[model samples]
Target chain A: MPLPPSPPRLSIGAVAGKTVPRLADLPWLIGYAAAFAAAHQAAAGWGGQGFYSLLYPAAGVRLALLWSRGPRLTLAVMATELIVQTIAGIIVPGQAGWLTAANGVARPALTYGIVVWLVRHVAARSQSSLGVAPMPLGLAAVTAPVAATMAALPWTLFSPELTGVSGLRQTVASLTGFVVGDLLGVLLIAPPLLWVVHAWQYRPRALHRPTLRQLAGLAEAAVVLGAAIAASTLLAEIGLGVPAAPALLAVAWIGLRFGRTAGWCAIVIVAAIVLPFTATDLPVAERLALHMSLASIVVVGYLAGSFADAQARAQSDLSRRDRMLFQAERLKTLRAMSVAVIHEISQPLSTLAIEAKHLHEITVAADPDIAQTAALIDRKAAALSTLVRRLRRFGGRSVDEPSALPLSALVETVTALTRAEARAARVVVEVSPIDPDLVVFGQEIELAQAVVNLVRNAVQACDGRVALSAHQNDDRVVVMVANRCPDRREARPGMGVGALVARAIVEAHGGTVERVTHADGTICATLSLPRPGAET
Target chain B: MTLPANQPDRAAVYVVDDDHDLGAAVARLLCRHGHAAEPFLDPVMLLSVYAEAPALCIVTDIMMGDLDGFGFADRVRMIDPAVAIVFMTAWPTTANAVDSVRRYGGLDYLEKPLDETRLLSAVDEGVAWSRRQRSIRARTAALSARERQVFDLLVQGHSNKAVADILGLSPKTVEDHRAAIVAKTGTNGLAQLIALAR
Candidate 1:
């Protein structure tokens, strides 16, 4: 399965957590809220309920993406939510003391727990599906719901007059509302928030954009926000009551189009503009209480959003570290294999030196067949030169960049390059029939290096005979390097040099590798890679 | 084969290096100067043929695989201790230089890529030194112990008093030993005495 997309930058905040002092966090939160409020006001009045709802879910997913931190960060977010809510209540003062001050604080704290729990659940499911360990899934699930429920308590208690209806009616309505809001928030806001966190952390080139793309995306978001506000205003003027649903739809649409921050900004703007109109119909105390409660909800949502973002970022970082560790281990194995290659090649070089000296002596004693001996010397020298070049290339020197290379040409080059070394070692190399037109995408030097490594390994593995072959089947080009196993006692552990380097090269080109050991004590390493211009 | 003393042939020099082009070029330069020179790419082959030959001088590289210049020079010195040795190396180190002088008695070290002028000059100096050593051996063969000591001091540019002090003798006695050295070599004056020492 393809790997999940990386999280975005805002999500990384979950990992940094309180590492960023409250003094710094507070201003950013305030700015985010103000932007959110303005966007909400503009979009909800201009756009319909569908747009607002769409915006909320999108914003919620974005926030969820950002919540990368573990339980500790969730708590911090809860605190931030409470603080922001309290401040907004104080500033608006449109509700009763108990409803506005106490209820406002309680609602956000509860929301924080629910959001954290749901995020942990989703992240667990994702990990299990990906076949990796699910990190702290159960912990998040249990703690999140409980924390969110507890945080919501003060709201129910402070506003008992309005919400404390007879029987189970009030309880059911409250529970339903809480579940729907939290679920919507987690699903819609969390994913985008996580994406942002991942993007910021890893900063993959594919996700990067030029200034023009960024500007275009931003401009589109502004237009969407304006439409949301117009819709919200029209709905309210027609005595359709407070257009909360329409305003939410507008937020969702913006979220989908422009991401979380934009969606949340639209939500806040709609709230600011609509809340004042709704407040005018109520008594001073009720108005104050209502205004404060709404503001508190906004603040709570922001904190929860940020907390989710940070957690996602932390998880991504952990995965990235794991990948790096795996790569390092692979490199170490390659280095160990190179030692064997050195041993195999050094013997040939020593023998060649001895033979050259003998040839020189014989030539001086009797100049008979001088031209033939001279040609032989030149040929041997050229072979030794090629061997040295291969060794140097394997030693990690900067070589020519990868380019489009034909499979047949690459095999021919490697065979020619290693012929002298193989001959000195008393091994024979045979090539299998292959398609001349079959081309593989990669640098010729790298492909040659891979082929050379494989041929050398095969020769070393076999007693005296090895075969190098290639074929094309469907979209994949298959190259097989086979050697008769040296006695069973000599069969080294793990993958041999040829198989390892060949596998590395093939995989780097988005291919698969396999090894087969025949019943007759012969080993074959096959590299299957996608042909150039073939759909993978 | 030993050459007759009356012959007018100039002494020959040999150069050995893995680089055939450079070695051949050097040989041509020596030939141009009226000296016979042979270049070899393999030091082992060069050593097997030239070990006993009385060459005026030899030039070789220090980094060859089978027999490096120093090893070849050691073999040459074993065969004939009087032949002059000049070493050429791509990488010159202090230890190798000192070792070359100590082990093979090489006259000088040259770094490659060699300048033609420098190589020729070094070859000339080495040949001249070898010729001087040959003449000294021929002249010193018949000197008595006392005369040999005085002759050595005179070649060192010492005065009569310094020679007497070194030999633990009076100035008159050292003068008598110097007179005997001049008579034994059959030279006329101090300049001729020094030339005879050479």
Candidate 2:
């Protein structure tokens, strides 16, 4: 024979809205009731006496069966209870026993049926609230008392011995208990569990460590949290008479601060405080309404907080994208610069290598004095090699790190190094007087690289005359490299390697760089850096 | 030091370039090797020098401000039909090589930064070819007008009958002219006659 087909699975949201329950829903109800019974036993002493002792177990079973499935599972549970009582009576063999068992089974079956009706009604109302149409708080308030009165009907109608007691009093007590229990279940248990499961499904792992700046942002967030809570609390006290406004404020603050986890903790604490007091006098309908209201607030706050967090994360991503683009552009400029440098330097280096080799051979075979001359030539070649290495490092890939560097000394050194190149190309390089003690914070290698690029570009731009000058204005130090290119038209601003790199370096150091073409056709690159100890 | 008497018929090596340093360097190297090398900074100067004496081999830079190496070689070939040309460039490419072959009669192309060893070797090869061409010219110059015409006809692969019809003479007269051409060229067979034509 073929195996029986399994029942269809329904999502939690579907369970909340479905009109009829499936066969599998009955076992789920039993499990829910058993769990509630265990929770009640753990809370109150398990050995407690009297009918009140049974109340916790009975309420647990009722709530578990109520929320686990629809009216169909509830009706099955009621029938199961009746069957159990009838079986006990059959075993006992007495008229009084059978009559008492029948009465007991009948009463509970009636009460269970009422609970099923109440749960379905409330679930319908909650579904409507989730839709585009707004849920009326007035309708919920009225439903709480009505559902409570229905729950109490079986007890009142079956016990005729207590005829003098008003039905209204019993109805009120039953309604209060039902409403309180329902509110407690939703507010204390629902949102946090949903949030945990949602978080697990969506964001399962942390990708990055918090940087120093991000840690500082977290500190700022704490201050903002405190302020938002105070503001929300004041608004809640003025609007709603609930004494727990401050506590609700605290929950909202934590949600906005550390996010969803802390928010749920705050919700639980507030619910535990409010549930007992609100449940005491009111009918079941009013109590349930109160719980639903509180739950709604927590859910809305959590969602809003998550949205704000996502926006902040997106902004951070944009900043990182911009930084990458800037780095890529800088790299492209460096490549072009290296190519130009290679083309310019190759001829000189080749000539020096060949001449040195020839001189070495002649000295080895001829005069002793020529040996000293060859040694000097070798030293010059070594110096050129060192210069080439420096140029390569300047153009090569490296991370940026800040250190104290003597600005004037760096400028002077680059000028001296490029002097020979300038002379060979028949161009003049002049360095103006600068303060000896001026120290700027930057990556020394990068700063030197940028300055070299600018000077080289300026030399290439001018025919022969180029001036490098430095001046201090208040808290800023400005270095200007100007070249006279009278016949040449204005070149595109950021064309060469040095100008592009100079801008990157200066900006990296929290400074500014500007290129100005004068009326006299002299192109000037001005680099302005903050004076030592000056605020950026 | 005794100088050789002016051999007016001796072929001269031509050096044409825009770079003063490179042209002078090549001229000095050529002089050391006992070859007459004239250096010109411009194609116009090279043309002027060629008016005095036809060059044995022309070495020129491909890139110049005016009259690039290819155009100069073409003009030189127009003036003197027998001069051989070689090209030097910083950019060596197959297209340039093909172009040099097509336009300038298949001259050797050298890439710069020019290796001195390769430059000298190419120059020597060009000079040796020029010497062989000079010798051929000397032999050709010794032939009488009628003998030269008969030799040209034989080199064209015209049989005695075809040669007699084209020359408007009898086949016997054509045969007589062919025998004389064989004697003057010092060739024993028709294959040797083709070798002499080359």
Candidate 3:
């Protein structure tokens, strides 16, 4: 799975993992209920027989709450709605009975449970990605008609004037109105609300000030979408009817160019511009045509924005893989060059020592002063030789035949080579005793270089101690380098150049390198190689 | 006065290196210390004429152009099992050190710009080791199959009765074989035979 576009943040209440309402949650619940009831009352004016609302904005609030804030918040909001509505049925004049009020709360509750299950098990499971656009749009498309029919049936069945064969046409009209109204309401209102709630959930501590390019892009999107809305409304005014293709094209351009937030904003802007014209006592068929046109705009914007986001993510992944391959090639060339240089230098160093020793041997009795000078020269040459040998341990590229090397010996050599660096860093390198007979088939020097790189990285990163150990697990020998951090939150997440080189060498030997960060702050890198008989 | 590598009793020692100067200096140091030593610039060139005059000991560099020091030691051992070999390299590693003794039949692995005291001591031990191995092979060449079996068991600390039981022979027959083993190998007693076997 790919990483999410932005890191998700959770509210303190949600982070508390509370499944029941608390005293601290009272203010939030009351505010949510107020918003829900206001939208419900606005739809009630054209609500046919107080059931088939022409535009049900309250459906948007219910779905948004369930999707973003989880069940506890949604449930609390619904409980408050039920109490307020039941009291209003008693207090307000010309209000429906308590059953009607109760149905309002019960309908949203049922839809919330079904949408949650479908989003979790169906939408999220199918794609393995629940990005802002695709997941909510898919859920809305599936649940709208079903929820609308469920809410429309009770009113159609209970009314006395619309009974038996006389009521059949009215029943069909009511169902059609409810489905169109509910689908339009959800398609328009739910996505923008979901976007707002998601932005709030993952909001940073400091408000993000948009860059100059972002501000300029937003201005450009506003200008294009505004022209689209103005041209569509003008055409409707002049009796040409509302042509939706031009406006939809503008919204799709904004979505594909400016990303999800700007695209969804463009859809909302276009819908807000079209809503008033549809409300001017127009014919019902014309109004439904306008609503269907706006729904198409929303769907197009959602899909275009999703494809753009996926393309951006794939480009980033390809770039990172390219960088790792480049680093591995560079490291290989450097090792070969260093081995050549060291080999050339060492021969002269050998000649110098031999000459100094020969000088001391020929002049010891005749002149003590000359003999002492020769001894000092020989000592300096020896020091230079020691330095060259130490350099070879790290940079020597082996071209020798591969053999079955004992794991114990390999571990010992790696630890010994890295001991100086560990001591300088004030880190302890602990090696567990490996099995004497367990062996891996590879060139010893190269494998040591691979392991030494891992151990050296651990020593540098560790707070105190780095543990080095190896064991035979079935057919492979697993060598582990682990560092336990003092604080889990401080663990670094990615590999460095040395680690990439280690991975390249290990992989060439029919092995794998896997890194894992444990919950308790232990970061372990494991190198597993095939045993002698299981050689690749 | 010792001429260059012509003393009969001194035995020959050959030093092989790709670097002509280093190989010549090493051979010169060994000659000055009263041993018959000669230098060869290429390990491949040395291997061609090695069987014509097998040296008592060989000192070879590992990272040469053609055949490496370890490969050269393996070939030399095939030709003359009694000749001792010592490895020298500029880039020394634990793997190289372990392999010199364990895999290549090398007496020691030394790093170059070689320490004077350590190099001399290693060469001295290599020569003595070669002579001892040659003497042992010659001594054991005369033993019959039955006497060789008794010698093997006796060196492993088995008594005459144990050897007799293992070979399915009587104690008197085992005792006779052990006496023949000691006489053929020209050793003093059981202790001498055990030391020679080692």
Candidate 4:
């Protein structure tokens, strides 16, 4: 009989034409068909067609194909099944050609089609990517009986030997036998097939070659698997109550120890070796009991794989948070550093802005002093670039050896450097005659930084006058910078960085600097040091 | 070391900053704008000339050593109480600066790198403000002893009754003194008269 009008037909030929590379797809299709034929031929070799015992791998492969290839591959399944059964010559012994095809190919393929649809409905929410993760057990458990019952209709119709079992009781019994057999086949074969296909699809690259430790772990797992199977068989033969103990322990050990890949590998190895052994001469209840034992092991493997996935995710998440925190801390430090740098550089930038504005003013003035304005810009620019250079060489200054220097010349030189600033501010610059006999031993450049910081601050702090004086008393040379205080209300010193930096430099050079506020509110900063060959 | 007593004294800018070059540059810009400007590296110099009221507009920098811009301005208020002030700072003005400007009656608070147009505009407004203040001070100076007393007490936030109680006069007499104070100062209302007193 013809199939009742089916829903949307999904053909592998149509799918392959569109999605797959034709060149690659041709080889894959041929291989799928060969594997499909080979599983059937193997089953028949184990037992004749009349006695449909356990181990029907063709059903498992059919379900796998239906899932991985999608419903579009329905025609591929029917066509492949029809050809394989005809070649086996056991589809029907003396029936019409169409009758044989329907009974052999259409019957099993349609029943499996219904099973695939039922499993898809039940496992739709928890869908797996077929080979990559374990197929939901509910898919096979719910699909088995429906498939077995559907198979009985066309099955008894085509086979003349079972024509007497068309009664409802006979059909139900046949359905039961088919369910037990198909369920065993699917449980035993489907998981291992998916594991192999998944492994092949995602084979590791050459760059990720396993380490010796990983190889030793794999070897250890192999020894454990072999021992488990051997122990279970021995236990079953002796009629001990705990035949599944070894299987359950090995499943948990491999699953938890090495994660999903190793867990699936352990499951496949156990299924391949132990499944066929349980198929011989066993009563229905005993056979069913053995299938249940294997089913429980597969579920344990699934549980262990899930635990491994969760831990791996959590570990990666923790590392990501740590990386983000480190980056945030680095950014905060950079922001603080930039604020300090801006503070230092702002004086020069402000000077530039002022000078540029003044240049325009000078051009418009009657008898404008162009030369004076140009000189001012050039001087300010020089000061700015010098500051930049010093910043760049902050930690890398060449160590200079100290030598004796003329104290009078040093004072005169430092005063000359500050004269332009004093002239612009209209501040009086008074230098008491330096003592010709007073000299100190030190690095001139290092001492210059100390002197300039103090002198500049004095000029900035005085009203109309700043004075520089050098004197010698009792083997000690002293340089004094004095400024008339701006405010007489307790002469509060301005909080500029130059004073602090000057203090640090003077202290570092084995010299002492002092600040004093006179009763009249005139401020004095003095630097004193031991003259060469004289004690402090 | 002194300019003629009559030379642009009423249209002058006093540019005080700790950075001597910056002070000179600012003063030079004001001179180009036709205002006689004196550059002071130290804010203390303002104290010396503040009693003389030499500059109408004082453009100063904050963060000066010895005396900060606010301290200098406050002292300026003591000597020449009506000078217009413009503060230039390298850092962004904080909330404290806003409060200082409001409390001290400063004309403007500016940040550096100084925009030339904004600086020129602020100084021009400050010059105008200082002129207005000088005229108001002159008018207030013309008030009689009784009117001055009433104005001072009223501007100090004392009511007419409170001022009468303090000075042992009737509230009606205090109100008459207040009216005379407002008219002499050329103020439209008590608030304007009080601002003039300030």
* Candidate 4 Cα deviation (angstroms), residue A507: 58
Candidate 4 residue lDDT tens string, A1-536: 11111232347765455433335445545666787777766654233223354456666677666555444356566766777666777566456555644554656666675566655554444323331223433344336535655666565656645444456554554555555455545544555666566567656465577999999989888888779888987886798854877987897788777776687678777767656756566555565556556656765764575456545644554575566558758976875676567556766676775675456445555445775666567556556645543443342222325667788878777888888998898888899888787888876766777788788887777898988898886777888999888532211233344665567666676778878776445778888877788862
Q: Which ten residues in a row have the lowest lDDT in candidate 4 chain B?
A: B1-10
Best candidate per DockQ, number?
Answer: 3
Residue A243, model 4, lDDT:
80
- Per-residue accuracy of model 1 over A134-237 as CA lDDT, tens digit each: 22322342234345545655546565554443334444345434433333344434544555655775577784555998788777766766775677668758
Q: Write the per-residue lDDT of candidate 2 for residues A229-301, one digit (tens) a residue.
A: 5565576579854433444555556566654444555555555555465536554445445554564555444
Q: What lDDT does the true structure give each of the candidates? A: 0.59, 0.59, 0.74, 0.67
Best by TM-score: 3
DockQ of each: 0.01, 0.02, 0.39, 0.18
Candidate that scores best on lDDT: 3
Q: How many clashing residue pairs are found in candidate 3? A: 0
> Per-residue lDDT for A454 in model 1?
73
Which lDDT value does model 4 have at A187?
Answer: 48
The regions of model 4 sitting more than 4 angstroms off are A1-27, A45-53, A86-203, A207-209, A212-234, A276-292, A310-536, B1-198
Clashing pairs in model 4, backbone N/Cα/C closer than 3 A: A10-A72, A11-A72, A494-B66
User: By TM-score, is 1 or 2 better?
Assistant: 2
Cα lDDT of model 3 by residue, A296-370, tens digit: 787677556655665565456557768767976898798888887887787888888778768866777767888
Model 3 chain B TM at 0.88
